[model samples]
Target: MTPTQATAARRSKISPERAQELYAAVLDELREHGYEALTMEGVAARACCGKSTLYRQWRTKPQLVAAALRAHRRGTLAAVDTGTLAGDLREAARIAAGTSGRDTRLTQALGLAVLSDEELQAALREALVEPELAAFGAMVQRAADRGEIAAGHPALEFLPAQLMGVLRIRPVLEGRYADAAYMERFVDASVLPALGLAPAP
Candidate 1:
């Protein structure tokens, strides 16, 4: 194993419950203090763990944040399968809406730090963006296979952007986070129409 991997493997293992607590603490610290002001010392204190443990486990702040995000979103979108594209999309929208407020706050918290820090940017994309995209792509592919929409439909490419855009912009435009009802309506009114599919009944 590489030295980094070797070191990581040698570090004491954290139980799943303990890990969740630590991740929660990390996100709580991030939301309250923002990325620039967040520190490993603060997280360790909040999580009630040694600073050395945090460093040993995650090695960097970006990595810890990424891990926390991944853990938070684990199995969320991937579990959506309703046997229809419209149903799946609506389900995904519902899931996105559930966390919209907290996630929006988290994104706002990170703000320009994400732009300036390459590691943070890449980590965030890997943790938050890529998995959801993959899940959405899988749902679309299944829909195509079921002949719900044309495989070459132009709207497929914009689906993720559309859903994510509404989630991110609703707060800015309406001063409110997108809720499940709003997201479902968006899927019915905007997304389904664009894909030449009818709204879910």
Candidate 2:
């Protein structure tokens, strides 16, 4: 057989489990080294696979990182039906706080880079921001239907921003991670009051 044929034969097709392993390795590397320092080689090494494996799965670093984030994305708010916006917000906050500190660190690590890199920006938004916004929007609609909040409340438009802002900044301001209790408190103290709703029972 020709050398080209031999090389092609040696390239194993990546399986779902193997791909998940690589995605996790990429997140681990990002947590350890930050996005700016992450490399295909580092992820490959961490995943115990060849660089060609990653390159074959994702053509570029941005794509690889994005894919990794998407792979690990949570569906915390997908089925959130607390019957009230306040309750939903509190529940959402609780779920978000369950995320590991590593995920939070990886997010902060990618902040500046997302500003300058369009692809990275889109990936970050798609993997992180968009899903949360979509689910929150759904919760708001449900609240409107239940008469807990007005459909046209101005604060309705900013709920995602408010929650995301607190989650992102708490570590900087408090020198501590935003845990479930903190999130629930923020929802009760800030989120509900802003929307003219009472705190959850």
Candidate 3:
């Protein structure tokens, strides 16, 4: 079977009950201990399951963390319904920045872990970055279909970075709220125009 199908099969083998339990335990461990300290042993201990069970499914801590990220993927990208590019992007930025803001701990921790391991970085991108960007890309495509932006817009794929970057840097640079409103202003001033939308008010 293909890799994804194999993953699906293994996931299916995991009783929904046990799967959620394992995932929850792992996330809690991440929240408390940070990524480097998060181990399969730790997760299995907290999950009250054997380490083999986690290893059978994930093989490594990076894989386990990557899966956990997939399980908890959320924010504006998850429910974007705005018909207009500007509106959609504003919400997208607001949501994308979420992980970098109050939930900043996880993002920061992941950043450190990824930098230390190229393989883990790839897996992290697959689990975290690619999915979110793909979701946002669909919105960008829809905007192009509506003539709000160019499909050929060079900055299209970089939308995720633009949205998340500001938030990650805001605390370091300005020490302010990168809230929905802040994200909105971002959409109006920088992102929208970059995608060829009209400048913000």
lDDT of each structure? 0.88, 0.80, 0.76
Tell me the TM-score of model 3.
Answer: 0.84
Candidate ordering by TM-score (highest first) = 1, 2, 3
Candidate 2 TM-score, true structure as reference? 0.86
Model 1, 1-201: lDDT tens digits are 864365347444878788899989999999999999999999999998899998888888998888887777634899999999999999999999988887888889887998999999977787688988999999989998998888889989999999999999999999999999999999999999998888888
Candidates in order, TM-scores: namely 0.91, 0.86, 0.84
Is candidate 1 or 2 superior in TM-score?
1
What C-alpha lDDT, on a 0 to 100 scale, does residue 116 get in candidate 1?
A: 100
Using lDDT, give the best candidate's number: 1
RMSD, every candidate, angstroms? 2.5, 6.4, 2.6
Prediction 1 global C-alpha lDDT: 0.88
- List, residue by residue over 90-152, the lDDT tens digit for candidate 2: 888887877735567878878689889998887667656787788988998888888877899
For residues 66-152, what per-residue lDDT tens digits would candidate 3 score against the true structure? 788677656648578677877777777767655555356566666577788887887778777777778787887787788877788
**Model 3 misplaced stretches (Cα beyond 4 Å):** 76-79, 97-102, 199-201
For TM-score, the strongest prediction is 1
